[model samples]
Target: MSENRLTNILVPVFAVILGIIAGAIVMIVSGYDPIAGYSALLYGAFGDRYYIGETIRQVTPYILAGLAVAFAFRTGLFNIGVEGQLIVGWLAAVWVGVAFELPKVIHLPLAIIAAGAAGALWGFIPGFLKARFRVHEVIVTIMMNYIALYVSNAVIRSVLSDQGFKSEKIHPSASLRSEFLQSLTDYSTLHYGIIISLIAAVVMWFLLEKTTTGYELRAVGFNQHASHYAGMNVNRNIILAMVISGAFAGIAGAMEGLGTFENVSVKAGFTGVGFDGIAVALLGGNHAFGIILAAVLFGALKVGALEMPSAADVPTELVDIVIALIIFFVASSYLIRLVLTRFKKEGK
Candidate 1:
């Protein structure tokens, strides 16, 4: 493999390892057994059919969320507003699900499309500003996050909700839930969203790697002035890239609305799924397959953390610490690369 590819793979691996080691040290200092803690975590995430199902369920949205972030990153955009885009997408999907009475084939796809459209619209604003006026996307997207959060909550209360803080459950035609899958997994909330997420990963890969549009977007990301001089429409590519990125994020919301929850609920705070996507994309090196693997690891850790408290008497917060440490190491990857280069030189 090329040195860049090797570094990309090894960096995340080492980050995970170092994070786990640091967690063990913390556990030792707290008079807890690291082995027992990790064992419990593993069992919780994969030991039983139910846990396995839940892990997959958790992974579904994560894959799409990571894709959303990774897609924007590849196009040289930092889409911090994925949280907001996801919220609007969830609301849009739930709205479509409840309002429509079409056949299953039509209803399901329509609801999903509504989510993607909502997310795309949300994404377009910042893209427009960034492309047209050179406004920083980070600032625009961050503000939009709050707008999405409050606007969604208001819609739930005054528009979608009859008397409660949540919207009505979606119709069966629009639902992604499956009886056979549920029975197979001891009634865990696994759904067809996993299939959708996987398909999305493939779509991202094809769009970014196999198409002329992808080349233009990537070139714009590399250098806008150069790309423009090379005859690529830099502004259009930037806008298109953000729109596609937002669509991915919106589908992540559909995974929750149509698959897991079957409805949209008013939130006291942000969901954090969109925020976590940033880390997922970072750790995955902004590659489609890498993002899938990263999402799975994150899903496993999140699902497994629930077991730590009861199984090993370890605080669930320790898992959070480990995750934070992993991100820190990943962020400081230059140091890891420097060390690797030095070691290679000595060996030669």
Candidate 2:
């Protein structure tokens, strides 16, 4: 393998191993058996058909959310507001699903489109500001997340809600739920969302790797001044990158509204999906297939964590600590590379 490819593949793997070891140490310190905890975690994630179904369902959204972050990263923009875009997208999808009465084909596509559009618009603001006024996107996106939270809550209470706690459940025609898939998996919440996520991954891969637009976006990411000198519209590509990224995040929300929950409820806090996407993208090396694998790993950990408490008498929080450590290792991969180089030299 090429050195870059080898490094890319090995880094995340090493990080995962180190993270697991650190987690075991923590478990030992906390008077828990690491072996039993991990065994329970494995069983919880894939031991039963039901657990497998749930893990796949959980993985669906993570894939899109990770893609959203990864796409923007490739285009040299830090899209921290994927959380906001996802919120608005969820609200838009549920609104369309509840309000419209149409055939299944029309209704489902319409709701999904509304969600992507909503997220794109949400993403456009920061993109525009950054492109036009040189405002840092990170600051704007962070603030916008709060704006989205409060605004969506208000809209749900005043506009969409009947009882003021959550919006009405979406129509059947607009839903992504699949009875056949559920039956196959012992009736878990698994739906067509996984298909959508897969399709999105393909789309991202084709667009970024095959198209001239993708090349231009990547060039801008590499060096905007050089891209502008090379006759590329740097500003436009930045905006487009964020728009596409937001669309991916929005679809992630639709997976919840149309596939998982089929309704929109007032969230007490951020769903944490967007934040997790940052880690997913980082671990995946910002590649399409890599993100899918990373999402599945994270989804497995999350679903598996539930069983830790019941089966191993270990707190579920240990999984979170492990995840944090994995991210830490991934982020500090330079140190890992340094150690690897020293070891290789010693061996020589």
Candidate 3:
């Protein structure tokens, strides 16, 4: 058990280290100061209170998005529709925010719940198809993504438009603001979403590791044939897994709309968060705690990329190159295992 635990931790750590080393080599070949670039990246993400708050803000969506992918992965499903689910969640939350007039106590939670429900419904389509028709979830999810994008844009233009490419601002009552924190850090948009994310992590961990339903889901994931032979309802579990995953992605969208953007707009492009979540889920080993750690790392990279070019004269795109390399290294873990085994044999 200890060896397994050590291997689990070392895999991601070594992958990240190798990725950074590869990134440094690329930077040197490109005539850039790798040390300075990395220094700027670090400072930009954690140099001061403002950057810390921004990092937290960026991490909010990543947490939920990572959870979305990780949850589906646990059930042996690939949820490529998280991008669409996120968009629909944003639309639902913003629509509720503008269409209703209620007290703060009722309005905010209502909008958030509605957003999650919308996302779950979107996820249900592919889930139902897969359960009933043996459809490939990958193809169905990819198609659903495009459908969600176009349909969401149409809704914004035709029904939800407010004389612009955006919806009306959410009512102040429903806004997730932090006036106390604002007085301390000059009014950053970081709010109570961090708390939501932390709570979600705990809840997911409990649900997956400490519940009968979670055991059934994992049994189905490990061997659907065996699960069915043992009398577990595999089809229902599949549908439920996708719906739960979509609900998490929907919460990510709700956080972005209500806590960050405060409104919905005609998205000129996909958020791409759903796709990123795949990499996050893989890097984190699809564990809830691991996902949170992975999300924070990715969030730091994103926040730091903005300041790298301006502060250190490195191209912002360098961060993208580094992230890509990290993903590649993680996906190709066989190389790392080979190296580790060689070292162990030599030491012995």
State the lDDT of candidate 1 residue by residue for 144-186, as single tens digits: 9999999999999999987579999999999999999999999
After best superposition, candidate 2 residue 119: deviation in angstroms? 0.5
**lDDT for position 327 in model 2:** 99
Name the candidate, 1 or 3, with the larger TM-score value: 1
Clashes of each: 0, 0, 0
Give the clashing pairs for model 3.
none
Whole-model lDDT per candidate? 0.94, 0.94, 0.87
From the highest lDDT down, the ranking of the candidates is 1, 2, 3
Q: Which parts of model 2 have CA positions greater than 4 angstroms off?
A: 343-348
Compose the digit string of candidate 3's lDDT tens values, residues 285-305.
999999999999999998988
The deviation in Å at residue 60 for candidate 2 is 0.8
Ranking by TM-score: 1, 2, 3
Lowest summed lDDT window (length 10), candidate 1: 1-10
| Candidate 1 residue-pair clash tally | 0
Q: Which residue ranges in model 3 land beyond 4 Å of their true spot?
A: none
Off by over 4 Å in 1: none
